[model samples]
Target: MAWDYKVIDGSEEKTDLGFRDEPALNHKRTRILDACKRRDIDDLQALAISRGGFLTDAIRCQAWPILLGVHVDQRGEQDGISDSWTTLKKHRDEGQVKLDVNRSFVYYPNDDTQAQLDEKKSQLSDLITEVLRRQPYLCYFQGYHDICQVFLLVLPPATRAAAVARLSALRIRDFMLPSLNPSVAQLRLIPDILRAADPTLYAHVSRTEPFFALPDTLTMFAHNVRRYSDIARLFDALLAREQAFTLYVFAQIVLRRRDELFLQDEPDMLHFTLSKLPQDLDLDALIVNTAALFERFPPESLRSWRSVSSSSTLKTVRDVSACAAQTLEDGHRFFEKHHRELIWAQRRDKVLRTAWANRALILAVVVGAGAVYFRKAPIWSNLAWSVPDHYF
Candidate 1:
């Protein structure tokens, strides 16, 4: 087969081709996620060691954080796992579990009147106490802003307060970094599922960049999409009713689609099917999805709600978001309304001050000149009028 290319060594060789076994890969991924949820560090560690050869996504999300603190990566270590864990402990140990976890900000007003910022602090303190009394274990749990919000929405005022207190520390920024593990996982899998559904997109990536293909779309479970009850119930009948819960989407999507995408050298049909799913999901939708995952909303629910990071007390994060938005918009509006006037006033002020200073200087010079002119002129006139000793 290789007669003319003797000088060139055939380093690359094609492997044997066969139909893929997808079920087995899915089972393997499920085991990884289950262990992660349980905080079973040892098993996760073992899996990482076993799959060291494979480009690992699970290990980075789960077991990698365990070593996040001790060494390996220092820059992210403090804020990544350690800081989050510390805040979690602080809330729990200081009895902040029952204290409102809140941030501080002020609301905007229609009229420019007295607006105080310190008013909400005490109220939030009380709310935190009430929520924590109900779900104390929610203290160490830091992920999304929705969980605490769901508690606030679902519970009694007293319970809402306590839950708000504990969940208040959850930051939006927390959803951005090493904390962004879930989002990263979901985003990575978006292409996976897309590729499964649409292969040409997958083929372009694989042929050009092997590392860039998506195998599934399950990380969306955490995104908290509201499914029709009928649909969810039907899915439940096939799997553990709770298994398809959006919170468990990472497990379902990635685990399920791994073999379909991974083992299949042929990226046709399946990859093309996966590629067409919508990518631009809104944050509000994300909030709604996660909220539905842990807390089952009434099927006939009228409202789509969200959870937020608390301030120093239990006030609505929506309120805070609104307030902040209002403040920014108001400030912009105020600047827009008054900018020309402000500039005119400033110019007028500079003109007035300058004129006043110049006037004082001119007045002093005039008065001095008048007195000297009158006295000196009179003397000169008299001297000129008197010709020697005679009066002229």
Candidate 2:
């Protein structure tokens, strides 16, 4: 069950066994297992971000639930747990989920037969449908299946549904909204982070919109990173930290390629290069650097912090996630409140845009009529000018 890592120089040599010290793999595994046994979440979180992430998926099966604030021992025991989520109710996004699920397993389990892949896709669809139906408020985005498939591949069947539900409601709820605005707001943090961490590179790439990072941050890099092992390692750190940590990881990615990014003269070139991550990314180093950047410039210190309101799930989820008393109920309440506010804001914006358009049209018509009258009635125009001159 050891994870494989290729050498950095395009060589076929498998250099990393998912541990810094080869002998310490077993020692680290023992400590992780002990933490699981003791249910020591703090220690586990520290270990997850340390040198090699939870080592193997076998360990992740136990550690991930703990990170998401779910107890692996008490699987399916959450309040309102039921079989009806999969069978009785139908979510609005189930159709989209089926379409995406059919396209799942495109990158991982390289040796799976067609039948095995089909089975996993069916399970992936069921898992997503279960969450969306139960939390009818959550809207399914296209790449959601990418994130869900990681859970499906790693966690057991009984544990998968609750874990995905908690993750959706808490971790990635911003992306599942009726619109992508909340998620875009989160991407805005990347520029602020780069501005603080590497001002030169930030200035170099300032012309580009943060949309280049949408694929990475929106799906938690599940859609961008092709390897299952690489993404699982990434999720280890993402789950262990605050929700905003994904932006920092992406900022680190940009900073890592400062030299290459600097060479690109046009903003479009910079954006195109950054839209996708490097295939040979050293995730362990990237994770470590992200932690340092986060510590150096925490979310509150960022210039973009003022842009995200206190009521946003971006802020609310981060606030409750670290609290001992936080529950899935808190996530549900926050989502409902945010959803209402977003709908209201959209309506207000629509009204304002319509009003402005009408005002512009009316102003244009008045100007047009005045021109026509002046052209047709030169005497009136002369009188108007004479009167203004006499008054002045």
Which model scores highest in TM-score? Answer: 2
What tens digits encode model 2's per-residue C-alpha lDDT throughout 197-270? 87888899888999999988888899978877788888999887878888999899899898999899998888
Name the lDDT of candidate 1: 0.32
Global lDDT of each candidate: 0.32, 0.80
Per residue, candidate 1 scores C-alpha lDDT tens digits across 39-92 of 554454344323211112222334332311112243433211222222332334
Stretches of model 2 off by over 4 angstroms after superposition: 1-15, 18-23, 72-80, 319-325, 358-392
Q: What is the lDDT of residue 376 in candidate 1?
A: 79
Candidate 2 C-alpha error for residue 300, in Å: 0.5
Candidate 1 segments whose C-alpha is farther than 4 A from its true place: 1-191, 199-392
lDDT of 1 at 36: 55
Worst 10 residues of 1 by lDDT: 1-10
What count of clashes does model 2 give? 0
